[model samples]
Target: MAVQASPQTLAPFLIEPRFVPRVWGFDDLRPWFDWSRFEKGREAGDPLGEVWLTGDDCHIATGPYSGKILADVIAQEPRAILGPVAPRVESPLLIKVIFAREKLSVQVHPDDKLAQKYGDPRGKTECWYALDSQPDAQVAAGLKPGVTMDQVRAGIQNGTLEDSLNVLPVERGDMIFVDAGTVHAIWPGSILLETQQNCALTYRMYDYGRPRELHIEKSLEATRLTTRAGKVLPVSRPDRTILVDVEYFRVERLPVRSQRSSASLAASDEPGPGLSYLFAAAGSARLTGEGFEPIEIPARGLVCVPAVGSAFVLEDLGGLDLVRMSPRWPAAI
Candidate 1:
């Protein structure tokens, strides 16, 4: 199969913000959803609202595209994005724009080896895109300078774990890349877009002194304890584009520019041989492929194209910015 953009379709999605609980109440959407609530809470000023633009919240779609479950889809198409069939299902990536109403638990993810060693079904490697931030919004990226693994483990047990983690304040548009084994957390009052491998393995180090359950022994085994080192700072080219790399995904940001936009189709910009999913993050753009409709993906709307066919043209229809994501190598993934 070739890489091509076919008309995209939408799967069902839940208003995933944590505070208010309603599986997916349309009435509660205004307050429950964070970034792009239509009337109440925070408005996601874009056309597709926040959910549709980044279908990370969308649950299930079609063959090999699994939502809420990774094993099943990978079983159907191992090479689709999770990689060549061999062991268990490996989702190439997972995406989510987190609205942290409260601090997230300090956590670490295992790599493939550790996951298998612990008899875990999957591991995690992910990144973040800051869409909104509060004055005190911060992320625990790495360990504090000069902290050692032995010190980290002891700190967790002693209740001083926060002191051992690197706390970095974040602003809107900031990007952070997290490889496996990195101890990290997204603080409350921030909205972020997260991209990671389709795995659910997370070892919570601490949950804010709150009596939340702790994944202690497993976390101990999963924690890398290596001093936080070599964390990358967010960088945008002279063109204001940012690229962040996680173990499973490579994501790029293109600020909406002209009424007309053009770029060569590159796998590095996407994830696998599968077609890229384009969402009008902040603007209105029309995508015209060789044989498809000149479909318009408004801000908050999404479109998925298969990895085949010729390059298409994207035209920004004023007051619009867009985010386009695909595999770095569609065939190889």
Candidate 2:
């Protein structure tokens, strides 16, 4: 008999399309050649990367959660989830699959204070994991070599800022770290996973003449005028063991060939609460928790474990890439 999967609170996945017309459109973004196929100015939806799996409202792209929303289920038990379930009912992390057909806008994200000031629902801090990429695919990261913040501001004023930005080529399996206030944009011909705080507010510094109007003034105010400390380095080869660790959350890439169970990351006695978001990028997996139904997550789908009692196991049907994200970090701001 097949091994019975464990039972746990399983929630649906969400995908919100950011369709824009222009030089930055996925059509233009497609030259990055990160995905498998495209049909002239159009991309498929069922498997779009930027689609969010388990977010608030659970409506953008709903599913059979099989129980209450993660936030609600967590109320009965804290350890059931991996991180602190906040009063706001928002998951600390916003996970996405990003398929770039063209370069995204040159943009900067705001910190919490500025986010609230600007009426943004969440602060944006994100990281990228390249699933595929074309030979010439590249990403715009930080400033060009030797360019200073003052020089950047001057370029903005003189319309020569593009020259001051650093562009780097990328390939499949590459990882990029993007912090709030970091000047960056995704280049075309690349497919990747983006894990970030649960915020959608973006301040674009440049749009390359897309039909959408640029947010220059807001971008100017939100952007960190001072150049960031380090060079815009890309993590070409990340140890799947530790992919990206930030103040908000942690994203790890785990591949399972057979069946694997989740190792306990924290003990119940641990002080604060936690939550976990499991994504099946490839292949199917079964999720079992203490007080919920055993959920079957198909390839490219995701499930949220709201109140995980003790720990849960991920039984891989065969070959698969799993993205496990959690908010175990204390809020810095």
Candidate 3:
């Protein structure tokens, strides 16, 4: 039997959003996503903490590729879709919008070495871009300057692990890069855009008396006792800013100003030659390429741009704020 190939297009395709419920979730997800669009018939108190924008299971919402899973599309057209930097057949980066109403568990993730040893595919190194924050909102990242492994263990045993953490206040537009093996937690009243390696192997160290299981031995083995902190730095460029450049992925903030035409917007910057996830953070825009029909990307929506040589443009309606995330083969320090 002659097998047929799935259709391919260089144009961007929208991805359906997946809401994940959590115990520490918040009911409201605004500016980032309008929960009312998808949760119309649901109950009022279904607190959703994370909105998975891009995953293997995320399906295409429109165009000829509608209803097709992202993983399948990648598998069917690996070279055409993934371009020259196709790390694997599957997408290497995971994008999500996290809303924390209450404190998350103090956890640590293994590095690549430990992940491989523990029979996991990959480790998690995540970066957070704060979209919104309430007054006094804070996040605990890394251990205190002088905290040692012995102290960490003692604090965990004595229910004082938080005391050994360095908590810092956060606000909108702040960026934080969390390296693998760093002990961290996201405090209450925060909405963040998180980009991480495609892995979910979390080793919980402490959960603040929650009933969930704790991985003391495993977390301790993965935890780095040395002092580490994520600095809140401003991005250099307004048109396109490289927010995070690490081994796993590279996240850039691209603000498409209100342009007259697609040609003018495309002239703003050169699109990289690889698979990139385009997330509409604020306003709506029209995604147009050479031959494919234009696609509308509403606020809080996500679109996948295939690896094509021809650049695409986002015709900004008002002001379109987008975050572009792509996988990097070798770690870019």
Candidate 4:
């Protein structure tokens, strides 16, 4: 049973990352994350592939909400965690660090309309920020120009779906957007920071004889011949780099070589909502503010700040490269 007591005393705090095992993952997630920092048995005898930063199962690592499930905290203080003008949703964003040693299944994600038709909250539309990549690293997004649905079906059946994929080379610091309804796949040689809608409704089109269930019918129905899925150019500023400002999320990259206010340290704070995520992509950072215990974010670690919560200051313990992520709602909703 979970404690239902009010955790209003909670301030901006660290979020424990959840490591999920995958067939195509690496045995060790190094340089980026300290595998020992995570609890045991998470690997499950398989190579770990993903580190979910803001997942619902992720527990609060500090302050009043320490040891509480992320979902429970949000449910108890929706307005405080989701902001005053944000949508009424369980989770605003699912931030993850993907470590793929091989290739993921050729998949497609349903859009909002298709997802809602199947009694789901919303669909997935993700953007990837490449943190590290080897030479010739690649990802497949959408289909080759002039490729038809019939060809896709035939390719999947004949096990040649890769031929129809529109492959893109990945480089460090690149931003790639994958919209809903676009068939996509993640390949090896790159470390990715993925920001997406909270929903995880993936429709796998094809897997390389991996014994995984394939969602052929749903994937076909969700596939689109053309989508706005490709490399997105980022705008660089003196203090931060604006990565993506899509309908569901806003992401920014900040360089903190010294101390700064949480307002200036993070993105989309101050005159707006209170919810935000500060990810230490490179070095270490320490967060301090009134009414809350100070918390430190190590390399590849994530921290969450609630809406209207306590104000804080981010001090750079080393070469801190932070990625600030937050949510935005659509007008029609």
Query: Best lDDT goes to which candidate?
Result: 4
> In model 3, how many backbone clashes occur?
1
Worst 10 residues of 3 by lDDT: 260-269
Give the whole-model CA lDDT for all candidates, comma-separated: 0.55, 0.59, 0.76, 0.85
Query: lDDT of candidate 2?
Result: 0.59
lDDT of model 3 at position 124 = 84
Clashes of each: 30, 29, 1, 1
lDDT (10s digit) by residue, model 1, range 1-333: 332222233221112222222111222223324433333223233222123233233433222243433334334434433232222333345555555555678888887778888786556767777767788888888776688877777878897888888888878777777777888877765666676666668888887677667887777676665533333565666443545654445566666455433344343444334434554546566666554446655455555543333346767787665555543322222
- TM-score of every model? 0.69, 0.73, 0.88, 0.93
Candidate 1 has an lDDT of: 0.55
lDDT of 4 by residue, 1-333 (tens): 121333353478798998888889988887777667768337456788998999999988898878988998788887767666665647779999999999999999999999998999788999999999999899998999999999999999999999999999999998999999899999999999999999889999999999999999999999999999999899887888888878778888987768878667544443475578989989998988887778988888898878757778889998888889887776642
RMSD of 2: 7.4
Candidate 3 structure lDDT: 0.76
Higher-TM-score candidate of 1 and 2: 2
Models, CA RMSD each: 7.2, 7.4, 4.1, 3.2
lDDT of 3 at 224: 89
Q: Write the per-residue lDDT of candidate 2 for residues 1-333, one digit (tens) a residue.
A: 111223344332332223223343343333323334312222453333344454543322333432345444333333334333343434567676676556677788887778888776657777787777789888876776677667767766676777877776787767677777777878778776778887878877776666776667777676664444232233223224556655676776665546665554323333444466667766777766564456676666666645434345668876578777766444433
Q: Give the TM-score of candidate 3.
A: 0.88
